[model samples]
Target: MAEQLALRGDEKLLDLGCGNGFIIEELLPHMPAGSFVGLDVAPGILQSARKRLDGADIQAEWVEGSADELGRFQDSSFDRAIALYMMHYVDDIDQALAEAARVLRPGGLFILGTDHPDSLGEMHEVHFKALRQMNDVPSALFKSSPKNRISLTNGQEQLQRHFRNVRTHAWKDELLFPSTGAFLDFYQSHNHCSASSIPGLDLGEGFFEELRCRVGHQVNQIITQKGHFKVTKHTGLIICD
Candidate 1:
């Protein structure tokens, strides 16, 4: 939303938790002369991000650090800041928002986009059962955890407490696979509910084969809906002053 919210031609923009530098790459055309900085905690992810935009030819900087504590920048140094899929992982939401406000100029805007609490249950439809079955464990193993949707209510409240204005929006989308087996395989690489985030997520040996069989049996009953599965999402904007 930085481009939509009037990120100027000369303003310095900061992207918090900018996974793989995707936004910086996409915003290159609009910010040919503007400075873009991407911040994330994962060093490996940042390395891959550098490769993603290797030949973009636009000026940008990628740093491995916490957005909640911009170690290198002075107060009120940035013209705009955006936090995408970030607040949930932060230990201190208010402090993060305060840091955003600290780095942003008085009139500058700080935007935040995070997964809605409602999306947590919906995401499970695609991968949770397999997450349990793959390990040959009981369903109760990980029935209660906030991997994809943590800090549901507190996050929103904290944003409101820190930002001057708050606005909301809702969205939903579907993930398609050729078959249920295809989906199980994809989850190996793409599942958001990792073991560390979810308690008792121990899928023992022969995970792939077992998960595939279970998913196929259930998927065959519902073919009219096509190969895709729907995912509901909600997001809001915290306009920092």
Candidate 2:
């Protein structure tokens, strides 16, 4: 992702939904003379980002705002803009993209990092299977990944509306969890073993506990048989200009 940005050591950059400044910390070194603006809706997240890059010798601004509304920035105010792994949460994808385009200079790049709908197929397979066995699983639990709204599969068509050229760079990789505990930690931390799909399901704490137990049993079986449980990641970047 840092390489795709093609930073020139001096460029005004905007990071939409810049969580914890992870991406900024990595790419800031390459742009010593450049300035950055990190915008997010969460004040707590913005604070974390500020602390993460506290002592850095660079120009950085943190704003609490939504991606769909960029009135804080003037037109052509940025040389580069990025929306990484957070577009699905935007209330309006088109509005956010349009705002990104409005802020970037002519010929500037907008790098969108997102996943394939089936990116974590292995995890979802086990997760859904376990949900199916449960007595009263919410039907919404089986719905597709939220990323499907603007994933590598359909990002080009959406980006084409605002950019003259849209290019997709894709890659695949796998994560091998050697233990059921390790995989369970990952599963629980992310999407709560798919329980997050139905935000309003109102299932109590006991419900998640049982769901985790079932999912863990299946993952343990896979690890026992294959020495490791594998998770495939299908992800890509849609670079626009």
Candidate 3:
């Protein structure tokens, strides 16, 4: 995606939903003479990002704000913008796009990465069953969370409304888990939904431990037959001018 942006050495860039600065670290080498601004709503996450870039010898700024409100920056302030794996959480899609268009220079590139709604079909099935067994089904757990506003089917149309020459590319990958416990750990870390996030799911001291036991048994049964379980990730990138 850094290559797709075709960033020059001296351009200023804004990364919306720049969570922990991992992407900034990766893109810094591509833009050695460039300055970067990382914006995210979470202060703790922004602090972690600061630690990541503390000694990187790069010109970077971190800001705590919403993606839909780029008013802090002047019009046409940035040369390019990126919203990777995070636009799904924006509350207002039109407003966020307007903000991106407002702050970016004319002809500036905006790259948006979001998940396909149908992605992780198998993982969701397993999670849904486990929740049902525990009688802890929250509709948001099955449906995408309230913040998720974009999907593969509508991504192109959404971007075309505000940007020219919008195009999309699909990225797919698979992850293999040696055991149910290992897979559970990965899920807890990477997925937006987890035991702690389920609304109204009362927690006792042994809640997750017991839930893991049940889900683990089921997962182990599958592993016993198949040797390992795989989770597929489906993501799409929208590149616009």
Q: Comparing 1 and 2 by TM-score, which wins?
A: 2
| Total clashing pairs for each candidate | 2, 0, 0
Per-residue C-alpha lDDT of model 3 across residues 1-241, encoded as one tens digit per residue:
8878988778899999999999999998888999999999999999999999899878899999999888889999999999997787677888898788888898789999888876776666676677778765445556654334687778888888888788988888988888888988866674425546665766765756656666677778889999998888888788888
Comparing 2 and 3 by TM-score, which wins?
Answer: 2
RMSD of 2: 1.3
Error of 3 at 137 (Å): 4.3
Best-to-worst lDDT order? 2, 3, 1
C-alpha lDDT score of every prediction, in listed order: 0.66, 0.91, 0.81
lDDT of 2 by residue, 1-241 (tens): 8899898999999999999999999997889999999999999999999999999998999999999999989999999999999998899999999999899999799999999998888998888888889997767777776778999988899999999889999999999999999998999878674576465678888878888899999999989999999999999999999
Give the best candidate by lDDT: 2
Residue 191, model 3: lDDT of 43
Ranked by lDDT, the better of candidates 1 and 2 is 2
RMSD of 3: 2.1
**Residue 112 miss distance in model 3 (angstroms):** 0.5
